[model samples]
Target chain A: ELKVEQNPLFLSMQEGKNYTIYCNYSTTSDRLYWYRQDPGKSLESLFVLLSNGAVKQEGRLMASLDTKARLSTLHITAAVHDLSATYFCAVAYTGTASKLTFGTGTRLQVTL
Target chain B: DTAVSQTPKYLVTQMGNDKSIKCEQNLGHDTMYWYKQDSKKFLKIMFSYNNKELIINETVPNRFSPKSPDKAHLNLHINSLELGDSAVYFCASSPNQGTEAFFGQGTRLTVV
Candidate 1:
């Protein structure tokens, strides 16, 4: 059984603040993904981390993976109101076709 | 154009009724998946198809059956629906296993 855990299941941050969401998995995986979802909407892909020390940044969000530690992080730099949503991290083990085990999402609410 | 799309963005039905949700991807991806997001926002994998073959089948109820007529389409049919089946069902696709997945807008199912 692959277990995925996320910290701070709910977060409320002020605009322009910085925060990091952590994702930890119980087993080694070939890839990890970060996704964002708004209320009543499906998930949108944020980043794909394929290797250790891989980091990707888009706009105010940056995601990094540390495969050795079986951990991944999604960092928000200078959060804005539009960044309010639910974030999820999923892991795909080797030899699987999108059989991802997702973490309990972290709901983020950024206010002015 | 939508890369991935699901029909019936919202569905409200009575228990014991049978219903089906349709999904199609235009990205030319070889793999497709169905995920369930529960009330607590826990996303879990239900089924996956690769090149029209059932690749991964999670421990979902037998009433929930997935059909893939072609490489680009996957449909989910649920019989004898229960209250617990009320959740957002998402359809996603990727070029291959362990790749970044593109998701559809999701179908919100409500059983009363």
Candidate 2:
């Protein structure tokens, strides 16, 4: 069974502050994804890290994957109030079925 | 255009009622999935469909059933809804099994 764990389930930050959310999986997987969800809204794709040492960035958000360590990280640089949302990291095992196991989301609250 | 879409953003129904949520993806992807998010913010995979074939079926209750009429749509039907079934349901699609998925806005199901 594959299990995903995320750190700092709840985060409160001041505007313009930086933070990083960590995601660790119990098994070996090569694909990782980061998604953001606002209250009462569906998830928005943030990043997709497909290989070892793969990193992707968009605006103030960056995501990296380390396949050897079975870990992924989503770094938010200079977060704004608009960035306040619940973030989740998911792991997909490399196979034909390709089902994703999701982590317990980290709820971020950014105050102005 | 919306890449992925789900019907009935909010659903309120009584226990033992039967309900269905419709999902469609215009991204021309070959894989679609159903996920449930509980109150604790834990997102779990309920079903995965690839090319209209069932792929991954997680440890979900028998009341929950998924139907993929075509490659672009996957619908979820729940029977004898219980209070525990009140949660957000998401529909997603990916190009293949190991790729990043595009998600719908989600349906918030409230079992009264």
Candidate 3:
């Protein structure tokens, strides 16, 4: 079974600070994804890291993948109140179908 | 227009009752998935269907069944709902295996 673990399950950071949420998986997988979910809302895709060393950044969030280590990371640069949400990292395994195993989410609360 | 959508954004039912959650994707994707997010915010994949074919079924109980009537629709039916089943259910789709997935607004099911 593929297991994904994330660190700092709940984070409370002040605005303008920087933090990183780590996602580590148990098995080998090349595709990794980062998603953000606001309170009472659906998840929104943040990044799709398809290869080792692949990194994607949008707005104030950046995500990177390291397939060999079975790890992925979502880094928040200069956090803002709007960035407060629960972030999840998912690992994909391709067999007869593509299955995504999501990590324990990191709930971030950015305050002034 | 919403790329992926799920009906009944919130459902409240008594234990042992049966309920169904419907999902549809207009992105012309070939793969659809059902995921459950527990109150603790852990997300796990429950089922995966590719081109209307069942591909991935996790260790979910037999009481839960997924039906894919077509390539664009995948619905989940849960029989004898229990309190443990109370959580947010999300539907998602991807163009194909190992690709970026788009998620729908989750259906929050509360088994009272």
Candidate with the greatest TM-score versus the true structure: 1
What would the TM-scores of all predictions be?
Answer: 0.96, 0.95, 0.96
lDDT of 3 by residue, A28-71 (tens): 78899998899999889888898899989898888999888888
Candidate number with the higher lDDT (1 or 3) = 1
**Candidate number that wins on TM-score, 1 or 3:** 1
**Candidate 2 DockQ category?**
high
For residues A17-91, could you state the per-residue lDDT of candidate 2 as single tens digits? Answer: 999999999988988999998988888888888889999999999999999999899899999998999999989
Q: Which ten residues in a row have the lowest lDDT in candidate 3 chain A?
A: A92-101
Ranking by DockQ: 2, 3, 1
Clashing pairs in 2: none
Fnat of model 1, as a fraction: 0.83
**Local error of candidate 2 at residue B108 (angstroms):** 1.0
> What are the lDDT scores of the predictions, listed in order?
0.92, 0.91, 0.91
Model 3's alpha-carbon lDDT is: 0.91
DockQ of predicted candidate 1: 0.76
Model 1 chain B worst lDDT window (10 residues): B94-103
Candidate 2: stretches off by over 4 Å: none
Task: Identify the runs in model 1 with alpha carbons over 4 angstroms from their true place.
Answer: A96-98
lDDT of 2 by residue, B16-81 (tens): 999999999999999999988888878888999999999999878899999999999999999999
